[model samples]
Target chain A: MAFLQPLIFAIVTLTVFFLAFKKYRVIYANINLGKDEKIAGDSGTRFKNMMLLAFGQKKMFRNLTPAILHGFIYVAFLFTQIELIEIFIDGFTGIHRFFWYVLPLGGFYTALISFIEILSVLAFVGTIAFLARRNLLKVPRFHMDEMTGWPKLDGNLILFFELILLVGIFSMNTADMALADGKYGFAISGMLYPLIDGLGDTTLHIIERFGWWIHILMVFGFILYLPASKHLHIMLAFPNAYYGPLDGGANKGEIANMPRITEEIKLMMDPSAPMPEEDPNAEPERFGAKDVTDLSWKSLLDAYSCTECGRCSSACPANQTGKLLSPRKIMMDTRDRLEEKGAGLREHGADHDDGKSLFDYISTEELRACTTCNACVEECPVSINPVNIIMELRRYMILEESNSTEEWNLMFNNVETNGAVWKMPASDRTSWINELEAEAEAEDA
Target chain B: MSELMASGQEKEVEVLFWVGCAGSFDDRARRITKAFVKILHHCGVSFAILGQEEVCTGDPARRSGNEFLFQMQAITNIETLNAYGVKRIVTTCPHCFNTIKNEYPALGGTYEVIHHTTFLQGLINDGRLKLKDGGEFKGKKITYHDSCYLGRANGIYEAPRQLLELLDAELVEMKRCKSRGLCCGAGGAQMFKEEEEGKLRVNQERTKDIVESKASFVAAACPFCMTMMTDGIKEVEKQDEVQVMDLAEMVAKAQDLI
Candidate 1:
């Protein structure tokens, strides 16, 4: 088995990457199933957006306590990965602490190890804090009607996974410190070394080896689990933040900037403008999105990027008012529909029809309840726009289906016939002027 | 102003004041229209009315997801404005201000649109308008409710507050003001449809914050806000003590214009 180490590592690494990449390709292809949306321009602005939002976690701090804990776990986890590089090198080369001599920076290595040691412990604490927030604290934002079952479990599992990984690292380091005769970096690892003292070299070696293997195995497990987990945000947050609107204007958070319906209507209004030349066989342009394929690519990407955090729903006035519409549920339903249809495609190849769409999952009641106040868009830490999705569905309902509430239909009729929402005529739109003029005349007299 | 003058063939009017459907039709909101017009007249501002030529800007229609009707209304109004060669538009209603300023450009109706608060603030800045040193509202505790369209949607918080400061009112803020301000439950065309069943009505929750501030007056910038806040105040049985007034009405009262 000693001679089989390289072979085992090769086979395991290949299988893990193969499975992860295969799933990733399927998601990517499914996301491409939507209509093309142009989020590709302005690399400079996009880069700045990615840096500020993804790297800086800019919007996450609106809820301060959670934001700080999130940053703690987030920043410390990245630093702890420096030690993972050391572990990976050691795993492959069958040599421990390979970086200790590879760089040969004696003083710097000591400082780096000390810094990483402190962070690993902080990461442990942060993981516990997150777990408490989910399980014990029961944050109002975390627990929603739709976030039951898998969503609730997935959140707990992520924190649990991180907690165990940190324990393994510290256990390995404690054994390593004891073996080196109490010399330690940060010594968070060595605090427990005294408990198992005088256990003999072979026993300590077995414990060290056990911790190392467990930590490495869990890392691989996380890689495989992430795409299926709400933990997918651990990877997709980067691109989601990057793809966010980079204009940074007064209304930068607004993603209601759709391909304007007004433009096509403007063309139809111009009597002299020749009818737009189109191939006679070409399908009519979609009025509004009815299905996933009719949605813009960003809408699909947004579904994938949702971390099920419920920040949007928590901020939503509609949700706060006890409306059936929860923006988090909207995204969850969208992602569920996407996964259902994507699975069908995977099992039956391209052109496979599920004979169902996003509308079957998301209801008109949920759609109409939205105020379109952009609260969800603003509060979304990942910049996912559930309002835009609602607007898209609404467009389909109004234009294609023509099924709307009686009040809505009345307003629609008033707008079309009278050119205003009120029952008053459009010619009487400025009747206030006459009334004001009469009052002014009486005052003057 | 006639089309010739509106086209800059003469210099009688510098801007066209677009009083939206609410300002024109709703009896309570009509007073806001009067107050704003009085201020404009007192300042001798070069302004003219679109009169009956004006139609709804389709803000409610567009917001309620009737894009076809919205475009019809928008295109007709844009044609009317463009025909008059209207350059700068000022509206007492933030809905009209937001739609004409933000939404109309997409439909080929581009103009420099100003909300009444900003227009009044600009008048004060230019010394064209003046506030009484100690008007009836002097030292009165007043709080401004941010309309979602004006405050969060277009970032116009300070202008209305600036106007309140000039009115010599003791400007107090609610627990939630400015960007974090709660909706009056009337934005996004909720003014038209009935509110859905909820644990608490949004405006009532907002009025609780206003009542908590102990302000005698709640200043609003939008007609919808005025309506919702007025309803909320009445719901709490504070209609007698707490009055909901528009910014224009407050200024007009201070100046003795309305």
Candidate 2:
């Protein structure tokens, strides 16, 4: 069984990586299913944004308390990787404290472990605070209508995983400290060793082994669970931030232009321009997004990068005013539809259709309620433009389906014939000039 | 008003005054247009209007997902502006400012478009416009509502607030202002239709914030916002207590230009 332990460890590590990679491929394929968008240029600005937004967690600081708590978990996650490296080495070779043996530094190992120990304690506190926020405080954003079943559970599960992993690390360290008579001089675990010192060496050894097993097993579980979890944002946030809207300029409000529509309009407006060579077998270009595939790949990336934080929904005017539209729900629905279709396509062929589009998941009422004020886009801790998705669906409804409200139709008609949103003629546009002059003349009199 | 460039009559003006559809027709919004024009006139700034040659920029149409109509309107306006060799424009409406400044470039209309607030601020900077001491709005409580198009869409928050500061008014802020400001329910072409069934309208929610600020006057920058906030103030029964005035009107009063 002693020899079997290393064999089992290697097998488990390989299986987790294999499974996680398999799921990752599906996500990659699903994202590529979207229409191509040119987010590849401007690497300099994109890299800067990734650093500031993702690595720096700049947007999270919009609210102070959660930012600090999130900082605790984020910092711990980064430091935990140091200890994990040693754990992986020890598991494979069946030699405990592999780094302690290999590293040439005298007290460096103790100091590093002590720092990680302190961070783990803070991570524990952060996890508990987050759990309290979800369950006890029932923060309005966390308890929004869309966060009912799986989202709520997934959020709690993530925290619980963090909590349990912290417990496992401390348990192993404290027990190992007692067994080794506090040889490592690790701060938190060394302090805890005194209470457990009365136990015999064999008992301490058993406890240490048990703790080590659970910690390693949980690591594997976490990796397997992440792809299916909204917590995947941890991995996806960097890329999403890199590909987010970077033109913080006068054109930030401009929606993307459809090249097909541009070409068509250009041809119609100028008969002298050479006619486009038509391909009879080609499928007609979609006017706007009806299904997830019609959306740009960046939008699909946004769907995947969404952590279900509800920040967008919390700040959404439509949601604030109690409209059916919730930007968070829009992202969730996009991801849900993608998963449904992606899974089917992955199993069957690319031609596989679920007989359902994104409209099945997102209602027209929700789409119509959006103000396109960019409130949701601004509030998002990660850059997810729900307005872009809404506008695309709206474009589909208007251009492909010709479905629109009577008022919008009237406004369109007015713009077409009268050159205004109202029925007033274009000749009346400068009538105010006459009135201003008349009022000035009357005042002079 | 005589400064307007008449049909087929050419004059090299400093800038073109683009009176958007609301500023041209809506009775309330027309006053904003007048106030802005008065300021330009008082400053001895040479400006002209497209008059009947100008049409809607199709802001509402584009926002309502009618891209074809919007493009048609945009191309026609761009052609007309290009024909006149219009190099710079100043608009009282944020919608027109945003559409022409931001959206028109891709459609072949590229001109230096300035919002009235930014234009007025620039005038004050150049010593072209001066605010009288202890003017009509001196020491008045004024809260400026950030229009989505101007504030968030184009990052013009400080320019409007900066103009408000010159008024000698006690500038207060709503709970949501600047980048986080609430919508007045007229953006995204919602002005054309009734709000989709919600517990309350967006403008009503926004008006609640304005009332909470307890300001005597709410300054608006966009005609759509002007319409929404005015109706919101009336809906909350604060129409008598609080007034919704555009930045141009406030500035005009402060400068004694009207």
User: lDDT tens string, model 1, A377-398?
Assistant: 7678886888778877887888
Residue pairs whose backbone atoms clash in candidate 2:
none
Clash count, predicted structure 2: 0
Question: TM-score per model for chain B alone?
Answer: 0.95, 0.97
lDDT agreement with native, every candidate: 0.80, 0.88
Residues A1-445, candidate 2: write the lDDT tens digits. Answer: 7788789899989988999899899899999999989874589999998898899998899889999999999999998888788789888988788878777655999999999999999988899999999999988999888998999899999999998899889989999999889999999999999999999998998889888887888888988898889988988999998988776533557777666666678889897888788898998878888999999998999999999999899888889998999999999999999999999888889889878999999998898888888888887888778888999999898888998999889889888898888899887888887888899899999
Q: What DockQ does each candidate score versus the true complex, computed on alpha carbons?
A: 0.52, 0.73
Best by lDDT: 2
Model 1 stretches astray by more than 4 angstroms: A1-3, A252-272, B1-12
On residues B1-258, what C-alpha lDDT tens digit does candidate 1 reach at each position?
A: 133113333446878888788888889999998898788878888777766677888877776667787777888999988887889989988788888888788667889999999999999999999888999689999999988778767878899999988888999999777766777888666778887777887788888999999999999998988998999999989988899999999999998877
